[model samples]
Target: MIKSEIKKLPGSQIEISVSVSWDEWEKYIELAAKDYSKEIKIQGFRAGKAPRDMVEKKVGTGALMDAAAQRVVQGTYPKVVTEQKIDAIGKPQAEIVKLAEGNDLEYKVVTSVIPEAKLKPWKKEIAKVNKEYEKKTAEVTKEEVEKEIEEIAKSRVQHVDVEREAQDGDNVILDFEVKKDGVPIENGTSKNHPMILGRGVFIPGFEEQVVGMKAGEIKDFELTFPKDYHAKNLAGIACLFTVTLNKVQERKTPDVSDEFARSLGKFKDLEDMRKNVTEGMEEEKKHELKEKRRGALIDALVENLEVEIPHVLVHEELHKMIGEFEMQLQGMNITFEQYLIQIKKTVDEIEKEWEPQAIKRVKAALALEELAKEQEIEIPAEEVEAEMNKALAQYKQIKDIEKNIDLARLYNYVKGMMQNEKVLEMMENVK
Candidate 1:
C-alpha cells in the first residue's frame, strides 16, 4: 500500500509527497535484486543465476535501495496521478526523499497539469454573433462567374511560335543578367526565362524594354528598382540589365462558347458551365462566411475566458506551431533553415514572436473544452470506433499501418475533434 499527500503548486503544477510501506518497499528491493542478479556473476554459478541474497551482498544495500526506490516511484506515480484525476501534461519531476534499507520509501513528484478555465456566457455571445451574421447572405455575381470562366479559358490557352517583335500579352523567352555598379547582382542571371509581356513581372521598365525586341536581338538597359521593393538592399537602386531575346510566342485564348465548354470534360454547354461555376462560387462563399463567423465566436469566447495556461502546454503548442510552419515552408519548396536565414531570425525569435498567437490558441481550446464539460457533451465510443475504422480503411494501401500510427492516441484525438465539432454546432444553432 502507498500513501500520498497532494499539494497544488503555482503555475498549474501539483506536488505529491508519496510514501511506500516497508513491506511493499521490501518486495521492490527483492525484485530489484533479481534484476541486478541478471548481470552479476558468481564464481560457482552461470551468469545472472546468482541468488538475490548473494547479489545484494555483491552490489551493496545502498544500490539495491536506490533501485527499489526508483521502481516504487515509477510504478506508483502514474497510479497516484490517475487515481487523483490529475490531468497531467508533461513528464513529472521526481525526487527521492528517503531510500533506506528497512524504512519506508519516500519521494516527491511535481507535474504540470491542465489548468482550470473560467469561461464567460459563451452561448449568449455566440447567439449574438450568429444573429448578426444571419442577416448576410452568400451570393455570386455574373461578373464573378465570368471571371472564373476567363481563368479556366486561360488555362487552356495555346502559345504559337512567332517571328515578329514581342508585343503585350505575347509570351517571350529571354536570357538576361543584371549588374549593380558594374558588379553582377546575386540571383540576377537567367537563361531562357519565360515571361509574358505586359505582365509587369519584372521591374517597371524591364518588360517595356523587351516589348520591341525581336529574336536574336540583344540590348542593354538600366532600370531602378521601386523604392518600396521587398529587398531593401536593391530598393531605389539603378541596375544595368543585359538581355538577349530568344523566342516569342503569341498566346491564343479560346472564346467562351458552347464548343469551348464541351472541350472541358463534363459540361453540356456554356450555360451549364456558367451555372456550375456560379454554384461553386456561392458554396465557397458560404463556407468562407461560416468559417469567419466561427472564428468570431471563438475569438469572443477566448477574450472573456480566464485561465492560467501552464508553460508546458504553451511549449508543446509552440512546438506544434513550429512543425506546422515547417510544413508550410516545405510546401513552398523551402527548408526551415533556409527560411530562417532569409528572414534573418532564429527559431527562438520566431517562437517568441508567435507566443501570443499560441497562447490565444491554447485559451480557445481550453474554453471550448470547458464549455463542452458545462454542456455535458460526450462522444460515443461507437462513433469514435466508426470514425477510426473509416480513417484506417482510407490508409489500407499502406502496409503495417498499425506499426506507424498509435491507434489509441489517434482514437483520443479523433474523439476530441468530434466532441469539439458537436459543441461548436450546438453553439451555432443558438439562434
Candidate 2:
C-alpha cells in the first residue's frame, strides 16, 4: 500500500509526498539485491549465485535500499497520478527523503499540471471575423490565359545560330580570362562557355562589354567586384577580363495554336488547353483565398482570447519548433551547428528569441482547445482509428519507427488535429 500527501503550489505545480509500505520496499530491495549480485563475483559462488544475505552484505544495505526506493517510486508514480488526477505537463522532479531498510521509504515529487484556459467570447469574435471577411470571386481573364499560353510556348522555344553581332537577350558563346594586377586569376578562364548577354552571370561590365561584339571579336575591359561580394579575396577589387564572342544565337518561340497545344500533350485543341489552365488558376486562387481567410480567423480568435500560458507548454512548443527547424536544416544538408553559426546566435540565444512566438503559439492553441471543448466538438472514433491506421501505415515503411513510436500518443495527436480542424471549419462557416 502507498500513502501520499498532495500540496498545490503556484503556477499549477503540485508536490506529492509518498510513503511506501515495508513489505513493498522489501520486495524491491530483494530485486535490487539480485541485480547487484549480477555485477560482482563472491567467494565460493559464481556471479549472481550469491545468497541474498551475502549480496546484501557485499553491496552496502544502504545502497540496496536506495535502489529499492527508486524502483518503488518508479512503479508507484502512475498509480498516484491516476488516483490524484495530476494532468501533469512535464516530467516530475523526484527526491528521496527516506530510504532506510526497515522504515517505509518516502519521496517527494514536484511537477507542473496543464493550466486551465481562461478565454473571452471566441464564438462571437469568430462570427464577426467571418462576416467581415468578404470572399472575392476569382475569374481568369482571356489575357491572363493567353499570357500563360505564351509562357508555355516560351518553354518550347528553340535557339538558332545567328551571324549577327551579340545583342542583349542573345545567347553568346565566349572565351574569357580575368586578370588582377596583370596576373591571371585562377578559375577565371573558360573557353566556349555559353551565356545570355545581360544575364549578369559574369562580373558587372563583363557581359555589357560583350554586347555588339561579332563572332571572333575580342576585347579587354576592367570590372570592379561588388563591395559586399561573398568572397573576401575579390570583394571591392578591380579586375581586367579579356573576352571573345565566338557565336551569337537567336531565340525562336513556338507559335501558340491548336496544333501547338495538341503537340504539348493530352489536349484536343487550344480551347481545351485554355479551359484547363483557367480551371487550374481558379482552383489555385480559391485555395489561396481560403488560406488567407483561415489565417485571419485564427488571428482574430487569438486576439479576442486571453490566458496565462504556462512556461512548460511554451518550452514544449519552442522545442517542437526547433525540431522542425532542425529538420529543415537537415534537408538542406546543413548541420544545426552550422546553421547557428550562419545565423550568428547561440542555442540559448535562439531560444530566447523564439520565446515570445512560442508563448503566442501556446496561448492560441489553448484558446482553440478551450473553444472546442465549449462547443462540445467530438471526433468520431472511426475517424480517429482511420487516421491512426493511416499514420501507422506510413510509419511501417520506415524501419525502426515502429519501435520508437507510441501508437496511443500518435492516436491522441491525430484526434486532436482532427478536432482542431473541425473547430476551425465551424468557425469558418460562421455567419
Candidate 3:
C-alpha cells in the first residue's frame, strides 16, 4: 500500500509526500528501465537489447532507483492533485524524503501556488473619475504645433568644427585598447572610432582620462573595474587603456527658418509644417492623458475591489519578466545564465528579489479583471468584430501571425482590457 499527503507551507507553498513500499519501487524500476533502455549505450550490447538485470548491473541500482523514484513521483503527482482537487499552476520542486535499499521509497514535492483573494465593486467611483476627466481638457492647439515645427527645424542643422581639446559632451574620435593585468579585452584597437564623451560607454574613468586631451594626443588612465563587472576576467580588477585621440569636434544647433523647415522634405512652408506639428502634438497629448488617467483608475479599483492574488500568478509574471530581460540579453549575444553570473546572483536569489514586484503586478491585473466582472462590463460583439477587421487590415501584408491567428478572441480580449483600463482612467478623473 502507498500513502500520499500534501502539506501547506508558508509563502503560499505546498509540500506533497508520496511513500511507497519497496515492492512498488521495484515495479517502477522495471517500468522506467524500459522507457530509458533504448537511450543507454552499453559496451558489448546493442542499445535497447540489454536485459534489465544487465542494465541494472552496468548503470548500478542507484541510477535505476533514481529514475524509478522520478517516474513514481511524476506519475502520482497529477493524480494526487486531481483526487484532492488541488489547482496547481507551476512546476513543483521534488526532493527525496526517504530512501533505503530494499525499503520503501518516499519523496516530497514543494512549490508555490495561488492565493484566494476577493475583488470589490468600483462603478460608483468610476463616475467621479469620468466627471474629473470631462472637466479637464484634452486638446491640440495651433501654437503648440508651431513651436514643435520651429524646434524640429532648428535641430535639423548642426554645426561641426575641429576642436583643439576634447571637452565634456564633445564627440571624440579615437583608437583605444583596454587591458587588465596586461591582458587584452574586446578589440584592443579601433581606428577613428566615434566616441561620445562622458557617456561611460567605455571602462570606468576612460572618458575622464580623454577629457582635455587635444587632437593627436595620447593618454593612459588606470581604474578599477566594477565589483560585479560583466567580464569574468576583469571583475574587481584594475585596468588601463592606451588611447590616442584622432580628432575632436564641437556640436552647435542652428536657428529655425523656412529653408531648415523645407529640409524635412516637401513641407510647403513653415505655416504648413507648424499646422501638421500642432495636430500631431495634440493627438499625442490626448493619448498620453488617456493612459495616465487609466492607470489612476486601475489603482483605485484594485484598492476598492480588494483583490486577493494567486501566488502562482505572481511567480508566473516574474518568470515572464525574467524571460523578456533574457531575450534582450540574447540580442546582445549573452544568455540569462551568463547575465546572472556577471551579476554574481544565483537564479533563486534573483527570483526572490523579483517576487514583490511580481505580486504587485498580479494584484493589479486581478483587481482590474474582477472589476470587469462586477460591472458586467464588456466590449460589444460588433466592437470586437470591428477591432479584428481593423487589426487584420493594418497588418495584412505580414505573414504567419496575421494569417493564422483567431482574430476574434484576440481582439475581444484586447478590447476588454482596453475598456477596463479606460474605465479606470475615467474613475480617476471623476474624483
Model 2 regions more than 4 Å off = 139-260, 269-271, 325-350, 390-405
Residue lDDT tens for model 2, 199-257: 79876777788898999998998999987664568889999889988888988898989
The TM-scores, one per candidate, come to 0.78, 0.73, 0.65
lDDT of 3: 0.74
**Per-residue CA lDDT of candidate 1, range 329-378, in tens?**
99999998988866778999999999999998898899889989989999
Select the stronger candidate by TM-score from 1 and 3: 1
TM-score-wise, the better of 2 and 3 is: 2
Lowest lDDT block of 10, candidate 2:
394-403
Off by over 4 Å in 1: 27-68, 164-246
Give the lowest summed-lDDT range of ten residues in model 3. 422-431
Ranking 1 against 2 by lDDT, winner: 1
Candidate 2 TM-score versus the reference: 0.73
Please state every model's RMSD to the true fold in angstroms. Answer: 5.1, 5.4, 6.5
For this target, which candidate reaches the highest TM-score against the unseen true structure? 1
The models' CA-based lDDT, in order, is: 0.89, 0.84, 0.74
